[model samples]
Target chain A: MRRPPRALVLLAALAASFFAVPLAALAWRAPWASLPEVLTTEVVGSALRISLVSSLAASALSAFLGLPLAWVLARVPFPGRSVLRALVTLPLVLPPVVGGVALLLALGRLGLVGRALESFFGVTLFGTLPGVIVAETFVAMPFLVLTVEGALKGLDPRYEDAAATLGASRGLVFWKITLPLAAPSVAAGAVLAWARALGEFGATITFAGNLPGETQTMPIAVYTALLRDVDAAIVLSLVLVAVSLLVLVTLRERWAPQA
Target chain B: MAPARRSLGRDAAALLGLAVALSACGGEGGGGGGQSEASRVTVFAASSLTQAFEAMAEELEEDSPGTSIRFNFGSSSDLATQLEQGARADVYASADEANMIRVMDADLVEGEPSVFVKNKLEIIVSAGNPEGIRSLEDLENSELVLSLCNEECPAGKYAAEALDKAGVNVEPDSLETEVKAVVTRLQVGEADAGIVYASDVASAEGEVEGVPIPAADNVIATYPIAQLTDAESAAGEFVDFALSKRGRAILEEHGFLVP
Candidate 1:
């Protein structure tokens, strides 16, 4: 192996520092002496519980719904497939606040379908735990769909075809052969979805509304804390950063070992 | 391997150039001669003052050619935090005395802030008052979805006071970060009722209706304005204009009670 150019290495180091400096600053300003007390506060505890429950629920919902969508997108060859893919992945790139507005329009009490749901079933998702899950799933599911689709498309087709040739049913081949082969990717996708959902702020606040012990997740807690208590906000931020770091390290080691 | 490495380095260099070019494009309107900088008076004001401030800015710019007035509108607490964190601005206006005091305590204000307007809280509901929400007591109905500004915001503080005075105990479904968000929630029909400044209801232009809060139960919010310590020479001029007769008229038109 040859050494990289000195100029390229210098630029790369500068780029890395750009991301590192802010995290370092956050750590520097953290209230280390009071961390335990701050962490034990009811606000922090409630926000943590809400964040954990909603993010995990969002990930489960994403996997349940995304797997089938991914399989279809990867295997089916149909007209407007590209358009369908674009529509499905729109949430991945669209601003989360805009996604929240769209959600309110579709599912809000006075919304097109929201009105029907409210009148027929007396169900209103706005400002509820279910609303937070819905908003998170809307933004997180696209990650799972895209990731699983890529993995599904990358799989060798010979095994499935061979299984089918041996007089196995489609369901049997899918259950015994396809799923096991894609299990690792599915797990990776679910983790990515969970991480994205954990950090969700805009959509949840916009759609689900912020109420402590209910819709107020960690990110929202940090924001609210920043307005009145900078120290508390810093502590909450550190918690989020620690969680995100753990997720990244786990992903690198267990899911993308080759990288 | 050497050839591939060289091509990769070249591509990286190209990417770096594109990034620099894009940043240059993004900076277009913000960059210019020192003359523009001197003429640019950036005023950070509370979100409830958005409509009135914009109108004042238009008139001020029209009266003084070559002068540009830029405004940053958000929750008063958030703006105060930003000013304390050294965000550059010519003038600061807060929705309540508490936030103004916070900035003064931080020594960010050039002089004492003067109260320029007084606003009272009102119950905001969808157009036609579908839920027939007539008073603060109506907000307590469990069937109605209520939204209020988070307690960290001035509007929220005022709303809480008013609700307390009215002896109403309502658990809001969501606590928004800004007064405008509360209005948006009401406008979008996601919330059945919310408490916001009377000016906000007037600014909504019939999208929502305001149910007057009896003066006995309403809490008044006083808006204060001051030039910042680091303000440019023109900063004082903008502050003066906001407190002028014409400025007061614009605010009054928007339902504010000019002091």
Candidate 2:
């Protein structure tokens, strides 16, 4: 029944508008009428497909790789555990472009490990579909790792211990008891990682290189369109906005815990 | 709980409206500052002009002590899009005529753009030309990885033209956003060869070797400079200076052809 403080309201209002106006402008200037034409084009179609596939794949890989790391960090206290945790979260703060460059230097044809891989197996990672996935996973895995790690740390160990006491092996206890209880957190982390990967730009462009129907995900396509067709770029941006909003809304209702 | 939830929703809606209003108030503050600052000139140039233009900016500053020149360099299409979006730049020197046409189509330019310099496509290979990429046709060897700028960039268009003229149908490993990225791909050995501006090869400083395209197959990419319609008087002066004999000499030193 009481009004909120006027100063707090004023500050909140300013911050909200600052965050919302750019999206509003994008909405206002978007070529809504020709959106279907723009979105149905070969370029948009391929980019959308690539974005979806790469982000989803990145999410799966993140869950696969990050869960074990999270488990180790949360349950096993090693000498350099904190340092290892810090290194794992580096992608969260590193500029995506620098991350891409690092990936290239470590995995490119002439890269340290890449040189051996190329000469031995005649396999190349650069400029391939797998390269895009690798770049996205590199930037996105940290989200899953931190989230699942937090969940693992918070989870009661008594349930796993009880299962172990009943003769369940460590692996069995983890798969049956620990994983089920951590399912919600894992799902949340995967969604967050997928969303992050979907919007990846700098690393993908730098490491994977932009190839249409291959490495040119939605962000790269939008960037290329900005260089060619502004209206088309706006249309692509609107598509991205729509995708992100959908993700947010779905997550809030089905996954995100209320404050 | 129901009452609290209802009130929270109402508060969010009210805050959203307030934010939109505040944003409207903020938007009006930027357009008024351009006219009062007459001694400053902001030039938006193509990415390939970065070194030459930086040198030119220093020279211009020395020539006119009180006037300050700022340069914004990126892909020509990107710069043109910024101009269309009403970026407050005094002059735009695009890497190609098509991008200049985009700006002119928006009625953003005050006068006709003059061709100040020209650039040609070169097949840039690794230091020793390990892949033996000697000509445009060699780029189509399928075994040799290749990179090029995205089709939206002037360098990409020029590269495509050169390839088409030579009847080469090489599938690029990656299409970069600008000439510099293509050059970088070659220098890192991520690509066996890349098509970039001759100036980019010159700037690579032995990191890569330039395989010259035959004159008959090469595309002469022209740089166009013009003042914006709403730019300050100093913009025109800067444009003139960039087109002067000294400017041509500087561009030549960077491996650009005199127009």
Candidate 3:
């Protein structure tokens, strides 16, 4: 086979290098002197704690909701299903800010469900932890749904039929048969959803608002730092990067089977 | 997942690139402004002033033909950092003076940034006070979720400063990026209360209720504007209009204080 031209190779290299440049730059500018203290600040700590907890909750919730939706979208082909699929994936196209606004419209105190939630249960989502989780889940669920749906369609159905014939309930067959086979994709989806939730900003801010010890996550902390305190912001960003890398690497390991 | 699988080679490369890009992109706006003057003057300012500034830009084009203005509207801290890293803003109008001061300390500004306008902090709640969050002290209740701008954002800083003065610290649920977002959450009831600019609350009108915080009197953040050291001839005119009679009127109409 003919080799790619030198100029083409250079162009591709240039395009690819935009990724590495920013990371190298961050490490280069890392304020090593203040990192330890910055990382431990009460505000940073609280935000990080919220970030970790909310991201995990959202990721788990998304998987719980997304997998079933994925299965239906993939296996139960029906009229307008493509449109339905698009609607489910809408958040991917929607600006996180817009998704946040939509969430507020649906869940805010004056919102339809928001009004019901307050009158019935005295619960208001705005500026609350539940609001944070709701916003994160709204944005991240699509990642899981699309990922799991793809795996479902690519799955071998005969095994599920074999289990059904052996007296397995459809639910049990789904739980025991389809899920195991799709474990890696599901895991990958969960990881993506988790990561998205962990780093989420616009939707969370619009839907949940930042409050320390409540909904302020690391990304929000970092953003605040960049304006209020650059050194602190840099340290928080580094922390976020380190944690994200660790999780992404672990997920990437699980993703190797597909590779 | 199937699409990812099909595009594995390209997508894997892109994904890793994107992660790196995210890490790198976070800090780049501070390092690259060596371009000569007279090409065009790029001014990054807070979003709330988009209408007035764009109107000013249009007027400037008519008044001073050769000179041109490009405005990037967002939060002040974002713009400041962008200035630090060499984003090449010839002028900046921050909703809070502190952000303006931050950029000045970096020696990027041309002169003392004049206090062009003033923004007051107000308690923004959903219309009808559905939760009856009567005042600022109510935010401290664990049941309330609040959103504020990250510390870097002008509005967030002002609120924090005001809260500090009042000796009230409520754990907010999210720290957003801008004032508009904080108000949006309030309107949606994602946050029962957000400390936002009086202008934001004023703009929202009927969608949300604005309760003036008495303690907020201590948190009047002066908005500052100045031509950067890097300004073209156009900078002088822009600054004049911002601080001039017509400019003051436009900002006043938007509910900003005439400095």
Residues A112-221, candidate 3, lDDT per residue (tens digit)? 68778887998877655678889999999999999989988898889999999999998999877887777777777878898899989988866665444455688876
lDDT tens digits, residue span B1-259, model 2: 2343344335434534643453344333312124444487778788688778878888998988767776555567656654564445788998878889999998988979899999887888889888877788777788878888888777888788888888988899899867777776675568888988888887776677888999999999888899998897678778888899999899989889987
Once fitted onto the true fold, the runs of candidate 2 whose alpha carbons sit more than 4 angstroms away are A1-10, B1-259
- lDDT of model number 3: 0.74
For model 3, how does the per-residue alpha-carbon lDDT over B82-140 read when each residue is reduced to its tens digit?
45534445788887777788898989889788988887888888888777876677778
The CAPRI-style docking tier of model 1 reads incorrect
lDDT of each: 0.80, 0.79, 0.74
**Candidate 2, TM-score of its B chain:** 0.83
Which 10 residues in a row give candidate 2 chain B its minimum summed lDDT?
Answer: B26-35
Q: For model 2 chain A, where is the 10-residue window of minimal lDDT?
A: A223-232
Q: What TM-score fits each model? A: 0.53, 0.53, 0.52
Q: Per-residue lDDT of A120-164 in model 1, one digit per residue for the tens?
A: 998877645678889999999999999999999999999999999
What tens digits encode model 2's per-residue C-alpha lDDT throughout A69-180?
9999999988999999999999999999889778777777667777787879986675456788999999999999999999999998899989999999999998788877
What digit string (tens of lDDT, one per residue) describes model 1 on residues B1-259?
2333344335434534643453344333222223544487878887677678878988988988768776655567656755554445789999889889999998989978889999989899999999998788988899999999898887888899998999999999999877777877776578989999889888876778999999999998899999999788888878888889988899999999888
